[model samples]
Target: MKDGNLDSIDKRILYYLQQDARRTSSSDIAERLDLSASTVRTRLNKLENSGIVRGYHLDIDYDLAGYPLYTKIICTAPVPDRDSLASQAQEIHGVTAVREIMTGERNVYVNAIGTDHDDLNRISKDLDALGLEIVDEQLIRDEYVCPYHGFIDEGDDPAPDDVDEVETE
Candidate 1:
């Protein structure tokens, strides 16, 4: 809470919200943390106002929703056209996410979902039309990593026990 830093209580609130923001109420958080409901509400409001808490979002199960094919496309565009290409990609029907990578052979990374292989192919073709040279395309077989618990721990630095020392070469 000091200068945009999240203290222990704020981190706990974030942890509970991250698990299920829509369902977790301020009262529930207050009861669990042994704090008053109004206190929790005030703190949550502060968090929101400070931009530490962005808007909550739903994690859709695209596969269950009938869009089974999830893919990541790595591509590059001309320096001047990067923004335009990204804007166009975002407008594509199935593109869920688009990111501009600052480093690497490929400058843009796109995440898209489709009903099947043919649908995915069409999405790729649409991207190709934007003048981006596709360097690689990979189907996301599984998402083993996630940032749902990213704010669980307090402090910027890692715990002493979490780090290991290496001998100098």
Candidate 2:
């Protein structure tokens, strides 16, 4: 979030990784960009140190892995401090993600994934009691699960009986 730090090569390296983290290895990046693997590794390490590359993650299908619920809760209120409110929200169990989104009036968006509706309800209650007034609370009923395309949901097809869908265990 600084000004004029990223050079052209740095931006290209970032874009390559962002497109497909697993597909492109350090060697592949070096080969494509015409640099040695050690150079690429150094740059990647720098990016990580600088906080540009936050973390690498693998896409997982939640529903197939026995976590089918994707619940999103939107809360609105006049808070004394934004950072403290965010921290408190994250403290609540089952709160996978919390973000302060400013669409029209400023509000906090809560995204939680639960194994069932009961778990989601518990999380909802936690959000309510977090000292923030609720403007809206809506469940993302149709949970989308895809490794590549997030918007295109694979639908409510139950996991195969014989197949055991495991996460990154």
Candidate 3:
């Protein structure tokens, strides 16, 4: 919490354990931050041993679980074959994610989900037979923005009319 620097009560115990780590309890985040349920279990075990609390996920929905076609394949190769083509596009069958883009012109980026558009064109012909050069292959017309809203001022102190005050050129 010192070098990692998440001060304000460890960002309010990671904004109430990212909004519900299994029904949020460290005595319900120490009674909503008045503190002490053993100091929110010692700062949620030092935010899970300083990895800044990494493992609690389960949003799913993948188009209501029927895998509603959301491809995005962007590939490219030969920079030493980009980590063996992102580890063979993570073993191929409906690759959920494989990003290895060190910086543009597509070094590899895959996110797959199927059951339509001919199962995303058979995962874009299994990523173009893995020789890697399929520069673009879109299809996800909707995830407007995500990150599922976790960290934004759970640490507070900005709202004095949302601040705006300097005047002395």
Candidate 4:
């Protein structure tokens, strides 16, 4: 649903899930939040049903897995065809993910992994065949990801001094 619909409990659940969905079970979260396991499960169900918690994805290390090449191919597509083209790009052999941007000439980004330059070139050609103009391709070294900080419970409300500072501002 919308951001406004999420209460503190829902945000905390999201925070824990983001940290490690596979290792962190509802029971684990329940223990930490002092909530019932059933409540955590129900909240997770609601999040998933509302499309907020889309899916738990694997953080794959292609480099360690024998695919030593990772690239992000930025592309430009006809505005009307951007979404479809991005979706179709995923069908290319090396493509791992595709994203559609809302505003810009280079509106589609394709993340692909390959064994070598040849494999990446093939993926690029496949994207071209789908009518996306390859703007540029960059080799990705590493990526860092973490939970949204705003979802974290600081365990204490702001002090009166902090509130006074805000009022002064």
State the lDDT of candidate 2 residue by residue for 29-137, as single tens digits.
6876689999888888888887878898766566677788877787774655555676788988777778886554447878777887889888878877776656676
Clashing pairs in 4: none
Candidate 2 off by > 4 Å:
1-4, 102-106, 141-169
lDDT of 3 by residue, 64-137 (tens): 78887777888887788899878987898888878888876688888888878887887788778888788788
User: What are the per-residue Cα lDDT tens digits for candidate 4 across 75-168?
Assistant: 9999999888988998899899999999989899999999999999999999999999999999999866766768755874423332232211
Number of the top-ranking candidate, with lDDT as the measure? 4
Worst 10 residues of 2 by lDDT: 158-167
CA lDDT of every candidate: 0.79, 0.67, 0.73, 0.85
Clashes of each: 0, 0, 0, 0
User: Considering lDDT, which of the candidate structures 1 and 4 is the better prediction for this target?
Assistant: 4
Off by over 4 Å in 3: 1-22, 29-35, 63-84, 87-95, 99-111, 115-117, 129-169
Rank order by TM-score, top first? 4, 1, 2, 3
For every candidate in turn, the CA RMSD to the true structure comes to 7.8, 9.0, 14.9, 7.6
Query: Against the hidden reference, what TM-scores do the models get?
Result: 0.76, 0.73, 0.33, 0.89
On residues 9-90, what C-alpha lDDT tens digit does candidate 1 reach at each position?
7877876675557767999878767899999899999999888887987677788888889999999988788888988999
Of the pair 3 and 4, which is ahead by lDDT? Answer: 4
Q: Candidate 1 local accuracy as lDDT?
A: 0.79
